[model samples]
Target: MARMTDPTNALRLFQHAFECGQIPVERGRIDPTLMFACDEPKGRTRFNYMRAEGRTLSALVMFVHSDMIEGHPCFNIGYAVAETFRGKGLAKSTLVAGLNEFTNGLNGACIPVIHIEAVIAPENFVSQQVATVIFDSTPVTITDRESGLPALHYMRRINLPMRRL
Candidate 1:
């Protein structure tokens, strides 16, 4: 379960998942965007990890740096688990693992506080439920980000003590 930063490994992992048809097409289509996003010259970082067993990728999670509410440092997590591994909570496990790695790796260098935020479409009840379970009573809100449509914002503090780098 190593977090992959090498472009080659990332691309290979993505291609394998796509070829298997185990990933939702809509979400899997972001592979190209992720490639571009991670290659940007800016300081923003995108961390990706693959769950593997004997050289085969079973699942992956991508954490992209983003602002939660203009001033808050947060990570937007996107994940996909292989069809053969969906119901066993791999998504949740991967998420937690990514969070821990991100917090430890970036806590002192990035913003002073670490928060995880998920912006889910209002009608995506399953995503909302997942966030609720992961965040455990953290504040949730509905926001309209100039799209004229409401979206759900779920937030959780990572409890990392942060200091300016």
Candidate 2:
């Protein structure tokens, strides 16, 4: 798993992925620079998993701390799989691995629970299916705060068990 910590490199990779149709455009424009923004509570964490070490990017999972639900941290989860890697369960597996690392970090920080939110385009059935399968929650139609477009919001609260780090 590759973690994009540099803004310039991250933006470049994301742009290349977009141009090659590896990333979906219907989710609305994304600002990868926000990954480095520290103004928001908990900020943002992104994990870019490559097919090979320092090689081709296969999928990316990003979680942005967007809100607090019932006094617990809430993050918006987003993911994309490379065009050639789609329909192969890559996205689901990548998300699982990425979320594991993310939650491990949270657990180390003493954050035991969090609310995970998924804001997906209404017509993006694949993402909706992934979210439903992973979260096992029904979505509610809501206007996306970032894109100002109608989206299906799926929320699930997760409890993090402590693990030896």
Candidate 3:
């Protein structure tokens, strides 16, 4: 349940994941300069799930604010699981946890009508399935934002459950 505020740490995790075969090379390396672009006051947040020893990264989830969805305030979601932890459903669960944290942080103060968006490579069927299960939305074909490749987009509205005050 560690939050990664430093771009370097997050990039390290990403590189590790890539080296361990979690991320395919075709996705291309993330530009160092852009890593902190979303680290603004109200732009992006990253969640890191580590193994029990707290040394190995099990999964990573990030939500970045985006205006690509038209009318709906959206946070584009991205995530990855370590190779050793893959196929165990770690990615989906971690993403759920990340979303809960993000929504809860709103604190009902100015609850914006927002939605979560997952842009996945069309060839990566596994992630597409995960996003469908979590978001319950049919994916629409679109060009990948970063790669300029074909992608599938999944989205669903999010709300902060009212607390019993």
Candidate 4:
């Protein structure tokens, strides 16, 4: 999977994903406002914040350092796999790679902890199963106050001890 480091490239990927309908426009999946949230700025700030990675735009993820339920700066991952790429393990692999990259702390200093959350529709059993395996557990159902959509929140955390080398 290729990790996108350049802002221009990231925006291009986002636009491509949107045009391909990998993300639902009605759900505000790729809405400009949501894409440029305060939690994640626009342009390079957002692009730099999310370690974007994928293969040929078929699958990709946008990850960020955010305060998870544990109140720590853990990686929060959001992804979209093109319809053709589904059931091919690309999503799972991409997510795993992204997690590993951040866990290893490519920049410097191990993050010490990592967390991923997936918000899925209750009827999206396929995605639920995928998340179950990646997260190693069933997701908890939650009411999304903002959209009022019934969503399943899947989460996982990793913590390890090691000397800074």
Best by lDDT: 2
Better of 1 and 2 by TM-score: 2
Candidate 1 lands at a TM-score of: 0.59
Task: Put down candidate 1 lDDT per residue, 42-146, tens digits, no spaces.
Answer: 676766655654335566667777776556767766566666666787666766665555566565774666667666666766555656656776545566453
Which of candidates 1 and 4 is the stronger one according to lDDT? 1
Clashing pairs in 1: none
TM-score of 3: 0.66
Instruction: Put down candidate 4 lDDT per residue, 1-165, tens digits, no spaces.
Output: 322222235445665655665643221122211222212444322211122233234555556654555554554456656655567876666555555544544334455555666677687676666576568877788874436677777778777455566
**Could you tell which candidate, 2 or 4, scores higher by TM-score?**
2
Poorest 10 consecutive residues by lDDT, candidate 4? 26-35
Evaluated at residue 107, the lDDT of candidate 3 is 54
In lDDT terms, how accurate is model 1? 0.57
Please give me the total number of clashing residue pairs in predicted model 2: 0
Task: Report lDDT per candidate.
Answer: 0.57, 0.62, 0.59, 0.52
Model 2 — which ten-residue stretch has the worst lDDT?
A: 28-37
The runs of at least 3 residues in candidate 3 whose Cα sits more than 4 Å from the true structure, single-residue gaps closed, are: 1-53, 68-72, 161-165
Candidate 3 per-residue lDDT, tens place, 58-111, comes to: 666667777645565677777776667789887777666656655655556565
Off by over 4 Å in 1: 1-13, 16-44, 68-70, 122-125, 138-150, 162-165
TM-scores, all candidates, are 0.59, 0.68, 0.66, 0.60
> Residue 114 deviation, candidate 1, in Å?
2.2
Q: Which stretches of candidate 2 lie over 4 Å from their true place?
A: 1-54, 162-165
Who wins the TM-score comparison?
2
Candidate 1 Cα deviation (angstroms), residue 157: 2.8
